[model samples]
Target: MKFAAVLNRDGGTLRNADLAALCDRMCQTLETAGHSLSIDVVAGKDLVDALDGATSRRSVDIVLAGGGDGTISAAAARLMGTKKALAILPAGTMNLFARGLGIPQSLEAALKSFTDGEIIAVDMATANGRPFVHQFSIGMHAKMVQLRQKMEFGSRLGKIRASVKAAWATINNPPAMNVTLSIGKAEIAARITGIGITNNLFGEGHLPYADNPAGGVLGVYVTVAQQRTELLKFFFNMARGKWRDNQHVEIHQADRTVLKIHSGSSKFRAVMDGELVRLDRETTVEIQPGALNVLVPASIAKAEAA
Candidate 1:
């Protein structure tokens, strides 16, 4: 098969001596798997267009994205609904989407799995027409993404620090957002601190299916924690995947939702996949299932079959 490997060298740390070496190893691994490969290292936002060119010109069968969640989200946007399949390299912190796919974080291990993997149809959701593979979130999680992105130590602490810092900041200044949500025939309103719409259901302790991305529904989680004590309880429940146990948090499954947020005295940040986006008083999220084809470890597929 012909493959286009789109790697983002600057997606993680801006300075690195191993960039060239990592690319070389990736190339060698794919070529050894009997694939005709074309490689490019995306440095900035413009590289998305460049990657589009490489894949289209080569008539690539698969595109391997080597970056963090944002880079993967960018490449996935281009690859979604196409005949091509996407494989993640997970060079960035968190790599939430990659972890969901059961892709190994180590470059060599991931590349090997790529060659051994099989393509699976997975759902992708859109927020205001923007594609997100894993999740679209509003509220405290969004603020965390924003705060960590602005921090000078992003590359230094990697994903773990970014998560920790975001958690800390969110706790310090929790969002008290008044949200009006319409899901299907139900019109509901509440004052919430955060909202998450997931293509595949995943929470702090829950395990999303590794082999099936096309679950055909979106998981919507609303956080209603408004006070510090309530927030602590919310965290405790999240650790056990029993967040729904808390009356402060609500979970629903929906095909689509229209949301309006009254930010009031505080700012609102929205995170799509892992990218931070700010929302005004109103925004809409629609679930578009089977929007992307992904590659997953073959073993996962067999497990599902059994």
Candidate 2:
């Protein structure tokens, strides 16, 4: 298969990487595996154009996107519902989507995995009409992301530190909004401190990402914790992977949900796949099952088949 590799020069670990050498290694590895490859190392600002140019090529069968979750999510949005498949090179701080896809977190190991990769269809979600591979979250998560964006972060470790501090800030002054969730014929109303709709149900005792990306349903989680103590307990339970046991939390599954937020402020924010964006008052979130084609490690493919 022919591959077009787009690496974000300013994203996460790539900012300090030897990009030229890394690109050479990737090209050599793919070529030696009897596949053709073309690489583009561009600044973060130019990532979308590079991706567009690559995917527009008639000869390109797969787009290998290297960077953070946001970069991979952008690549997924372009490739979704298309014949082209996305192969991830996890160069991000969290690399949550890559972990969910069973892709190696290390750059070198991820490249090796791709040499024997197999293409598979996975689920993708959307907020209004915008596509996302991970989760769409509002309230505390959005507030935390918004806060982190303001702090100076030059490196991957710096970003992690910023996230921790931001999370603490969010816990102290957690955003509360009246939300109505419509799932099928059922409607639930609450004043939530945080709410998230994930591409698939998150596996327990692990990072907050789907273990089965093709699960064909959305995971809905709402936090009703009002006080600081309750919010702190909620965070602690989440970190321990026992959030479901928390009485202040509610978890559900649905193919689609209509979320209506009743807030006086017209400009609310939400976090989609780790990037902060303006939230619509009423957002339609749904899962498109098997809408994304991904090139994952052979082991993952085999295990899924079994």
lDDT at 111, model 2: 96
lDDT of each residue in 164-275, candidate 1, tens digit only: 7777777878877788888889977898888888886664456332234666777888988877788778766765667557898788877888888765634567788777
Q: Model 2 — which ten-residue stretch has the worst lDDT?
A: 261-270
Quantify all predictions' global Cα lDDT against the true fold.
0.75, 0.92
- Over 4 Å off, model 1: 13-17, 154-159, 203-212, 236-242, 264-266, 304-306
RMSD (Å) of each candidate, 1 decimal: 2.6, 1.0
Cα RMSD for candidate 1? 2.6
Write the residue-wise lDDT of candidate 2 on 174-293 in tens digits. 888998999889999888899989999988887788899999999999999988899889888887677677899899999999999888546569899999888888999999999999
Which portions of model 2 show Cα errors greater than 4 Å? none
Model 2's number of clashes is 0
The candidate scoring highest on lDDT is 2
